[model samples]
Target: MSFKSLCVAFGLTLSLAACAVGNTVDYRDVVPPLGVSGSKSVAVEAVDQRPYVLAGDNTPQWVGMVRGGFGNPFGVHTVSGAPLSSDLTQSIIDSLKQGGVKAVPATARMATDRTLLVTIKNWKSDSMVTTSIYIDAEAEVRDQAGTVLARNSVQERVVNEGEVAVLPPGKLERAKAVFRRLMDQLLNSSIRDALR
Candidate 1:
């Protein structure tokens, strides 16, 4: 075999190996700190997620994968993992409870006067040597009569410090950080203000 041909084979092997790494998607839960106090009782309604965010099987769709370094400038890869809207809804309810608000599951009756509705506008990640996860959501508060009381939009960006292929766990950690931050902002500020 020629020297150039051998080198080409070796490069192809390496690229395939890197791409194979971190193909499985994992989920992390968000837990908020306790301290802030509020005087509102709210029932968390089902969260609405954009259609393109999920796969046909109902799992979160994998965002496109990105390569590290500058060798293949035009290469795009697929990433695994996404948080379900139900999971996010639960997280928000938990955070609300921690923040001294009476939060309950949404029901047709025997509930609070106010209902919280959340819409996930964007939830995506950009992979590379360093990965950035972006989350954007909007929340609204309404009375039993369907009158909109208050609404707010929250967006968060988090960057992880590692290559996606080398450290797949770091990507999940960064995603958790972004989720936590978004929940914190919503529970402490946005939702609190809306209730007031």
Candidate 2:
């Protein structure tokens, strides 16, 4: 092929590539539904850090969603194959910190002065992309040697703005937000109940 033709083809390819790159979409940056408030009434204490449990294991627990099936298209699922568990855990930890509650570490020095066990039972979103996340969280706080300080279960459902009341496209995000809000509530409630 002639050099002139080769250069022209190369330039056209580069231009097309540039345009494609520029038009790339980023769903991650999509604006989530509003009305997510992380306010709570707990005076988080800077005290002993405790370990948490998930599914009967004394490990770093994750705020998992149950998953919306069939009609629940825009439900809580991974973006590009990344599981939402990690994000959920981080959100919970952040909310706990904001609420002033001391979190138990996953491992190391102390023998877990306290243990917080959590579980997410069911999660779903609707057809019009409206998301509704429901979580059945069980917080079982125990001292060293497995002595239960407090054991409580909390069920919270958070709804977001979308086309239908079913679930939203940002279902996973809504679940995480609601989990944070509910964590604060649960932490405060558990602490208060334990004290009483």
Candidate 3:
């Protein structure tokens, strides 16, 4: 190619690199599991414990960078449109209620309610020509004065490759599947009973 052609190619690459690679999709609204009877009263508090501080935050959000690859990790990130902690907290409460449990946010007072602390331990993706999403969370129930009653954790992963992985629907949509799986396990696990 001519010198002018090379210069134009380099400029084009630079402009593409300058484009935003951040993703923003809310990770809520999983299908609630069938409500169970004789569930217990509990207050829920969710926390995001992932240790990475990513780039770009124009709104209240939760973000995790996609890992694996050289330099900036494909310059992509997985983000949620709302603060993850509160979103999980509310989702947990709603799920518990739909499951026939008396559930509320930690801020709500109760006569004799167990406190459920749910934590986001990991939320990440790996990609090259493929994208693999992973997520895990732990839920612990404690009595008044913080005596642990029960604890359980759940994790999920999904891999996408070939044509679909690099095509439309984006990172956020791919990640939502893993998040849904994570929530489903929480609803049907021993942790839900322990909260009672």
Report, for every candidate in turn, its global Cα lDDT versus the true structure: 0.59, 0.41, 0.61
Top candidate, metric lDDT: 3
Tens digits of per-residue lDDT, candidate 3, 1-196, equal: 9999999988855543343244445555643553544556778888777655332332225444443323254334324445767777877777778757887888776654688887876665554445677777787889877889788787877776563334323644665666677667765557656664
- For every model shown, the clashing-pair count is 2, 11, 1
Per-residue lDDT tens digits for candidate 2, residues 54-106, read 24432222223322322222112334333233434444444544445554333
Candidates sorted by TM-score, best first: 3, 1, 2
RMSD of each: 5.4, 12.5, 4.9
Candidate 1 lDDT over 106-190, as tens digits, reads: 7545568678887876665655567777767787889878888778787877777655355544554565566677766665555
Task: List residue ranges in candidate 1 displaced over 4 A.
Answer: 1-28, 34-40, 54-58, 61-83, 99-101, 107-110, 155-166, 188-190
RMSD of 2: 12.5
The residue-level lDDT of candidate 2 at 82 comes to 31
Where does model 3 exceed 4 Å of error? 1-22, 53-60, 65-80, 109-112, 126-128, 155-158, 163-171, 186-188
